[model samples]
Target: MYRIELDRDVCISSGKCVAESPETFRFDSDEIVELVPGAPRLPDEEIFDLARDCPSGAIRVFEGDEEIDVH
Candidate 1:
């Protein structure tokens, strides 16, 4: 299983993360991105893509002991 974390303070609401993986990330009525608990269960490659594509670098994904930094 993969775990996701979002830095609400650093998020700029660019929506790139949502666009890249809608199932994984979404925007609330206020336009803040919300990460679903277990959605967007992407493969390792997609997780990396999401990290690389996030413009604000606010998203972080973790697998076991490994942590992926996503912006």
Candidate 2:
């Protein structure tokens, strides 16, 4: 299984992730990207694409302890 995480400190509030996968991500009170609780999950490839599309490179996908390089 793959795990996705948002680096809030690195996030630029681009909303690209939310726009691409609103079911998996959302904006917090401060407009930083956050994972939605109990939201529907996206496939690993879709998640990777989302990360690749992130301008700030804030989205990170990991398999176990290894971080996948989206670029």
lDDT of 1 by residue, 1-71 (tens): 76667788878999888877888788888889997766746787777777777777777778787885554
lDDT string for model 2 (1-71, tens) is 88898899999998888888888899999999999999877888898899899999999999999999989
- TM-score per candidate, in order? 0.74, 0.94
Q: How accurate is candidate 2 locally (lDDT)?
A: 0.91
Displacement of residue 70 (Cα, Å) in model 2 is: 1.2
Model 1 residue 70 CA deviation in Å: 6.2
Which residue pairs overlap in candidate 2's backbone? none
- Which candidate gets the maximum TM-score versus the true structure? 2
Lowest lDDT block of 10, candidate 1: 62-71
Please give the CA lDDT of all the candidate structures: 0.77, 0.91
